[model samples]
Target: MATEQPRSSGSNTQRPLTSALAQHTQKKQWKDLSTPEKVVTATKTTTNYAVIATGAVLVAAIGYAIVSELFGSNSDTRIFGDALEKVRNNDQLQEIIGTPMMGHGEASSSKRRRNRRIHSQVVLDAEGKEHLLMRFYVEGPDNEGIAHLEMVKDQRNKWEYKYLFVDIPGGVRRAQRIFVEYNKDAGLPAIDDK
Candidate 1:
């Protein structure tokens, strides 16, 4: 077989893919950006991390607030064992809260630490009637329970049970509210005008 000769450096000579790539790389321009842009440019990659961190913190706070409002709050010390003991005296309360999942149970370390309080408050309605608010979480291994109970008080300071609802958050926000309304209806008897 005849050996082929090497081509001379002319237009007919073709460059390899690697050499073409090495030749065509255009450098990006560095310019003075606006204050915001400068802050963003100086910390281009770092900014993503910073923004993500800030967003993460914000999300955590909002999550905490929503959980606190519905389940319980930190400022409200009336919760868990204490709330259970007090509510036990009422027949209506005992029936609603007493379930197979009512006994001693352990939850995840995160949940055990976060929702430690049972929310309790007093509010007046348009009729100037004072109402008591009680909300708490009773979490078991497979079950996470939310109890929202309201009791009204008269001038003589006697409490009248108003509404009772028990449900599980199921880790889904939409389902939690649905269960709240559903449990409240199923667990309580409708008031009669008689």
Candidate 2:
């Protein structure tokens, strides 16, 4: 006769993954988190987030400056001044004629747009002279919009406009923001103040 072996109890059987996870979650003392405890946790989390965000912004600012130094110019004030000088002289055709106009000027358009500031990028042409890609903005209506062009400095140090008008909307706007951030102390375009 063969001896019969007893079966092990079902309690010893392994639980399903889902039931195990449920048990693990149920074990947490979520209700034990009192109002004050919750507040503290919330405050800590908020402060941590704020610190991280500020750090990230600082690092990004530093990175932007470095990249701008490499790909862009460190001194954009000179570019802005040059553009203004060209506009003032009226002797430069490129600055006068090449300057973009939205449409036939209305009577209200006689009001010259104020707060005209330039975001400049210095590029080298085949001639090896440092040329500026200037993005200028106005404080007038949205219709006033923005303008971008390349202006080169002649031997006399006078800026002569080049054949450049960037009609790109979003890209130019983004570039303006990046340039402003790159030059942190530089005044923002009047549009951004709003």
Best by lDDT: 1
Superposed on all Cα atoms, the candidates' RMSDs to the truth, in angstroms, are 15.4, 18.7
lDDT of 2: 0.49
Count of steric clashes across candidates, in order = 0, 0
Candidate 2 clash pair list: none
Residue 127 in model 1: lDDT = 72
> How would you encode candidate 1's per-residue C-alpha lDDT over 157-194 as one tens digit per residue?
54555565555444533333312222223212336612
Q: Give the TM-scores of the predictions, in the order they appear.
A: 0.34, 0.27
Residue-by-residue lDDT tens digits, candidate 2, 1-194: 99998676667776455776677766336578889878887899999999999999999999998776455533465555444443333323222234432322112443575433345567776857767676664222232334455656655555555543323234323322111112222222235445
The local lDDT score (0 to 100) that residue 91 gets in candidate 2 is: 27
Give the whole-model CA lDDT for all candidates, comma-separated: 0.53, 0.49
Candidate 1 similarity to native, TM-score: 0.34
**Segments of candidate 1 deviating more than 4 angstroms:** 1-115, 170-194
